[model samples]
Target: MSSLPAPTRRSLLGGAGALGVAGALGGAVAAPAHAGPWTPARFKGAKLLAAPDRHLVGRFSYGLTPALAAQVRRRGGARRWFEWQLAPGRIPDPAVGSLRTWWSGLDRGAQELWSRQTSEIEYGWAVMEDYQRYVLLRRTRGQHQVLEVMTEFWENHLHVPVNGDAQFTHRVPYGDLVRRHALGTYEDLLRETITHPAMLVYLNQAVSTKRRPNENLARELLELHTVGRGRFTEDDVKSSARILTGWSVDLWRTWRASYQPEQHWTGPVRVMGFHDANAAADGRELTHRYLRYLARHPATAQRIARKLACKFVRDDPPQSLVDHLAGVYLAHDTAIKPVLRALVAHRAFRASAGLKVKDPGEDAVSTYRALRVAIARPPEGERGEQYAANAILWQTAALGTTPFEWPRADGQPVDSASWSSPSRMIASFELHYTMSGGWWPTAGTGYRRPGQWLPRRRIRFDVLVDHLCQQLLGRRSTATLLKACSEAVGVGRREVITREHDLVRWSMPRLLTTLLDSPYHLRK
Candidate 1:
């Protein structure tokens, strides 16, 4: 039986903020899990494919790169490139590593953060900004494109919003938890996330006791994380909570998952057909076994596959594609790589291109990559790096999604239509416009030597547009877009080159803003 918890903190129900809103509106309950695996007959039709490279880069990475495109070309095709991206361990992430040096707090243990100062709101936000910037830089610049994509997908799949002012400290470990198991077996990721202190408190499992079991974590594990809405019942939720009663974080061990037998409900419990047999003092082992069983459930396979297909394929992913991906996930016992490989190789994936629109975060990062915008602070060890990072975080927050900040656990939406509204579209254009003029408008496109980054020759308007089109979009400009861009800057078809820095400084931002707002840049 599905059940929603009464008015509490968060629900994470059906859609983004669905559960939270459900809680406020006459009480909350667990989501309605899928009755069965999705079928081809369910949706009637599937979206067809559009541009190949554009689709690949858009779906696989937050941003597109000439280097990333070239890598795919070298690998012979999108399928092989995807396979290669799956083995991110073999790929070095120097850009992310370099950013880490700037973010020293990321290395601090949970205990250190807890003891240092948990109540300082500004300080907590600063630490949170560092974590957010790490995620942003990695997505926008990291080499493991597919790995990053999966990281984002799994982060949302197992959403754990910040619990309080001090929980910002735990986000570091939480992000690590997601990244470590991002491409691994499903069981490992589930185990790691549930046991982590951040999730424990976020879902209220940390405080659950035998006297009063908190169903928050247990219910979501079934409804949101594993079997999904209809596969389990209310009794299973109660049982799952009993199984997890003693599973709390060890503040003594840097806030790691720990067990206190005194708090455990050692009596028998059952989640679906799996049972604990009421074996006293066996809660931990049963919890592990029960979770592993859930990991292997057929419903779980389909649930995870549908989510992956939703992310990588179309908004309403084809049920046929979901079934195919589910088979791969189940056959491999939920090892992530195999499921993704099947997804990349699927005909549905290749066909359903350009139909998906970009989310706010995706749009911002993609714009940065297309513009080759540098995310650096002032040179000579300027004191404003932290402020700069905070500024960028605020920028992304305005777009409606940033890392670790979704107030509810459902996370940002996956469908393109959610972000396609005219208000949001205009907000995106304003952001791109500001960045086009450099992060600070006064900085005037903010390159130490902007000319060096540009084409060496003093090119004419038409040639400049062509060069930028190739640079930013990886293709020649469409007739309509080229005409609009030229007209935006009052340039005639037969314009001539000129060596005028003043002209470039004055006009380039406007022209580049036009390019960024073009459908070519906006779509993928």
Candidate 2:
């Protein structure tokens, strides 16, 4: 097959920002409230994939990729590959290193971000953009796919956004907090997030004091963070507030959190079955004890398990599965790996194929991986990134969601229902069409710049269609799918069709876009 030409920087910058998808949505756009982590979607012509090859790639990673599928097969199957992913320390993430080229100050502290000496600027927009791109790259191309997937889930679970410079300064380290315990125990994860300056500031814990105990952090801790619901009362909220007092940020010292006994309320605090005395000044130790207790609570286990089940298994997970997963969570003392291992091993996970509809971010990542796009990193100041990033960001926004961009603490939904609207689906079709046509790739997809829709081997149109289906979907092209591709370029007979250059060239975008737009590719 011939290689496509690289888009010039001029063409890339010239409205590549829209990805050629501006105002291309169909019907009415759905409101932000329509989607969530558990929304159900009804996909048209969704593939019923019985093969574990596709299932594993879909479950553990963003979507099915040939490279990922081969890795799974190389590891002896899905389970072994999943086991390999569980220990990310064993995974060599060379792709993660390129992050510095695009996003600087990932290693800097709040002081650097506050100062002019570093790329960590006082403007929160820069940090937000860099971090968002960082998230996009890691999610799209990181070798530690499971870890990235889990980290995304946990980051959303412990949702914190950088809307302003103060938020940017503190929330810069939030991703680290999520990564540090991405596969560790939930107790550790909870304690780390709650103690972090970003969460403290975001949840108003930094301002909580003996005189004015803000219950925001305490409320979310019991209501959303830990126990989840009906298990904690207003008294618990008020008491937890007093316990969380003095967890203040040291602005003079890079916004590091420091416990102050002076601000802590002195008294015996009882939250549910746990009891601890402030000892007038030992609020830090007392708080830690309370947190551990909360983390170990059965309710917390059930809450986390239900969420996991919903994420990995199904939209509305069965009570049996939720209970079973909850036991797995508690049996291992809230250690994440065991619960996740048992989850994959569970019958529900194995049975779920094409069950999940991809979110906007997931769809975008899947498209990039499907096309085998080489992640671009030009000079520090470049137009390609601006145009490409704007396009991606807008597409994600149009889907009504993006990583860490959820304004609320609740985070973006994981269900398909929230993202199955006509408008979003049409936007996806337009985006994929643009990509398949090689319009947005300023250089091209993959290490071999100037991407091609046609395979290297000279094959017939029918064979080409079949090859594309396998390449993109890991399955053979159905008659319906083949007809959709062939007819797009006015090919009459399937058998009589030959290697017609112009027809194939014309059919490339239509065929590729149709395949990607199919419900099969939309679900994972």
> Per-prediction RMSD in angstroms?
12.8, 8.3
TM-score of candidate 2 on Cα atoms, chains taken together = 0.86
The Cα local distance difference test for each model comes to 0.67, 0.71
Q: Could you tell me how far off, in angstroms, the CA of residue 309 lies in candidate 2 after the best superposition?
A: 1.2
lDDT digits (tens) for residues 257-313 of candidate 1: 678888888776778878767667647777778889988888999989887777777
Candidate 1, lDDT over the whole model: 0.67
lDDT digits (tens) for residues 119-230 of candidate 2: 4333566667777767887777789999989998998888887565466777757887798799999989988898888898888887788999999989988988888878
Q: Can you give the TM-score per candidate against the true fold?
A: 0.84, 0.86
lDDT of 2: 0.71
